[model samples]
Target: MTRKAAGNAPGHAAGNEAGEETGEEPGEEPGAAHWLFGDQLGPHFIDPARGGPRRDAPLLMIEARSVLRRRRFHRAKAHLILSAMRHRAAELGDRVRYVKADTYRQGLREAVGDARVTVHHPTSHAALAFVRSLPSVRVLSARGFLVTHDAFGRWADGRGTKHLRQEDFYRWVRQTHDLLMEGDQPAGGRWNLDHDNRQPPPRGATDLGVPAPYRPRESEIDDEVRADLDRWSRDGDVEFVGEDGPRGFPATRREALAALHRFIEHRLPTFGAYEDAVLTGDATMSHSLLSSSLNLGLLDPAECAERAEAAWRSGDVPLNSAEGFVRQITGWREYVWHVYWHFGTRYRESNTLGHHEPLPDWFTDLSPDGTDANCLSHVLRQVRDTGWTHHIPRLMILGSLALQRGWEPGAVTDWFHRSFVDGYDWVMVPNVVGMSQYADGGRMTTKPYTSGGAYINRMSDFCGPCRYKPTVRVGEDACPFTAGYWNLLHHHRDRFEHNPRMTQAVRGLDRLTDLEALLEQERDRRD
Candidate 1:
């Protein structure tokens, strides 16, 4: 039997238990209905005035199977989200309704019964569209993000018709928030410490040990989730990848806080230096694995940034490390969210490059190791095993490879959405379709992030054991990335001729003696 939260309110019931139908009709009572999305589980939503649980409001949590069926989500990602929602409802104690339905719209209709409902604006575009379509529901602005919509709009208005750059926006956020700032200027006299970061992995660094993975202890909830997933797999009702093991992330607010503290003490110092480094065996290399919790609303982004800033002030960590950490939360995180809302739905469909190749089969499944390319295979293995790899690998390896090979932007975006534990529509679209793929025609990013194998060799250890040579651009032993790099330049040479950033690389392409033969060889290898 499916377990439900106990001790519900006197007038209400948990799950499908019988309760009074007094508020079943619309316009019957005030503050009678409130629904929460998976990402909006913070206590602030309960009582906005006092920031506590609302004892009188009827809370609803829905497990929508339609969302799961929309994409083949990682097994661990599904478990993490579902289990967290269940745990939140159980913790709320009373006046809570939890339902499992095929679609969110159906679930919301069932929960509301006949009462008028109020829903906070969702972080995702699809959810927002769904909530707006319901006649009985009223949508309110969401409360979790650090920057408000009005604030973001005002910032955008200041930019006028010109595209807003991340660096300028990042500085504005720092100055407005007074974080790591002295009066009107940055604390370190520099707005960015990015130059100090990006050091390659240190030799013999593997011997120093990596942070232990955050695997929560087994619970009844975990057992139930695992059973459900296994049943789905056996019955062929759902398709998911990755092993459904102990949830490798903190699910509750208290646990999230603990994880944050652990990261500050253990990983924050070296996070800046090795943030871009990619090693073969080590996945979590001095990087704060708090994005999942922050995105889920278990931890506030502002508070996390403030904590890192405080660490810098205390002299516990270097300015570069603290600044880098803070920049991610307050800068990139806020910027992307604003871009997603400002651009609206059409932003997702941007495909300026006009590339239309489907993603390779090896990306979806890595069983028996399909590819001979070590960098691709190792990174895919990390994702398949843990449902995550740091941003560097995402941008430099997986994303760059897709861009070089001219893969379909939507296909690449969908793969990212399904693969990561923290993947969401708002987060993936801007990062994948815009920044990583440059499919948005330099709207979100200044240029395409395409790179050769030399970059990979410089930043990572993946090239050392690879079968192909990183330096070769053609012939049988040529690294696919190197060959693909030249091919990509040749493909988009005319378009990027006027681009200042590509001028040097474009000029280098003229130096190729046998460009057509190299392109032909690359095509054959792909086929």
Candidate 2:
């Protein structure tokens, strides 16, 4: 990876002797064992210029079964992470010392003894604190993002904390990186084409009609992973949720690259228009299924954004499509990563909404028995079967339901982290706590993202055959979402009454003549 692509700055402590900083440049220390986390499998982690894992730096990889034992992760999520780590080990062959132990500490003791180890910055606060506490390891700057941590800190510091908006941050990133730019101006004369990307799915279409996404073929390595997962379950060592079907995402560098190429060549053109739309029959849509690859560190965000811009410049894809896709990686993805750290560890506990209800068994298990609401039921089933759904269903369908029901923000965040294939602590905390649940009280977003069935009916095909009517909210056939949306607003009326953005929604609540009956119905609702 290029120096510019990794967004790395010099002088990030490379070690020669246990916790002692070397005077040499990053990754240049000889005899330092380069430890690879599951999320840091890309070549940039060991790039000699970045730090000196040199051409032949010894590698340490630990597969701790306790990660699965501690939390009941989706079966596919467990399989994908382990497969990616094992695949990297197989690629490195003799250079890598792969150790499987019950805990990271145990694995480290078994693999490295007393040797000095250099590891890139871990993704979670817990992991970072643990590594910093370890005297035998040196932590380096994070990889796979477009902006450096220090750069983001400087930017955040310049702006006041509560008012740091994503649009402003996105524009700054575009200007700094010259992404989708025409000299000094943004291409197409606008920074965001989100308006163009909001169109609903094509009429009467079962799917997007685009070519299918790339799905990796399982090898013997996959067989071994499945067998081991099954064995662990049988022996009561680990537990998993969801179905363990054939692997659906890229697990190795080569496979990741292939997936990216397929997305760029076939799906990116129509990606922007229906980016937020959903088809019940089609889960993939025109979306790039590269989140798993990107989060796994198999692909760099800078590289991904640059390629999309290149496609626009070459006229292979429209400006909106390229710009929209670029904004995801360079703008939104990067913003969340920075926010996760800047918000501090206590951000997870922010519950301005004071929602303390626990999750229902059906919701936690991803069972359709939870609700007759077609959108919620279908989305849950999709996650149960595939460990994924596009972001719209995630935010609008699943998250919206949780918000309306007043589920605790931390529990919602953990559920998201445990369920999705691309989920990580850093990714889900900001997304669920701030964006999805609005529990941060306008920190990451302007307002709560919950909506009634009308929005869902407009954006997706799931409402057509739904047993509940989108327009009705006072009968047995009343849509849970339509009722829940107003019920939530009514319940929080004092909070929404003065906010300019919510005036229309708040006023609509006053027009509900059946408000008492609706409240009574929703209060007694179990399904």
lDDT of each model, Cα atoms only? 0.77, 0.86
Q: Candidate 1 has which clashing residue pairs, if any?
A: none
Kindly provide the TM-score of model 1 when superposed on the true structure, using C-alpha atoms. Answer: 0.92
- Candidate 1 accuracy as lDDT: 0.77
Model 1, span 77-130: residue lDDT tens: 999888788788879867789989988878877877767777666787777777
TM-scores of the candidates are 0.92, 0.95
* Candidate that would win on TM-score: 2
lDDT of 2 by residue, 1-527 (tens): 12222233321221211223234454356788888999998877777775546677788999998889879999999999999999999998999999999999999989888788888878888898999899999777667776767667667776777787999889888887778887779998999999999999889999988999999999899999999999999998888899989999999999999999999989999999999999998999999999999899898776788778788888999988998898898889888987888888899999998899999999899897688888888899999998999899999999998899999999999999999999999999999999999999988998899898999999999888999999999898899899999999998999988878898999998788999999999878744
* Lowest lDDT block of 10, candidate 2: 10-19
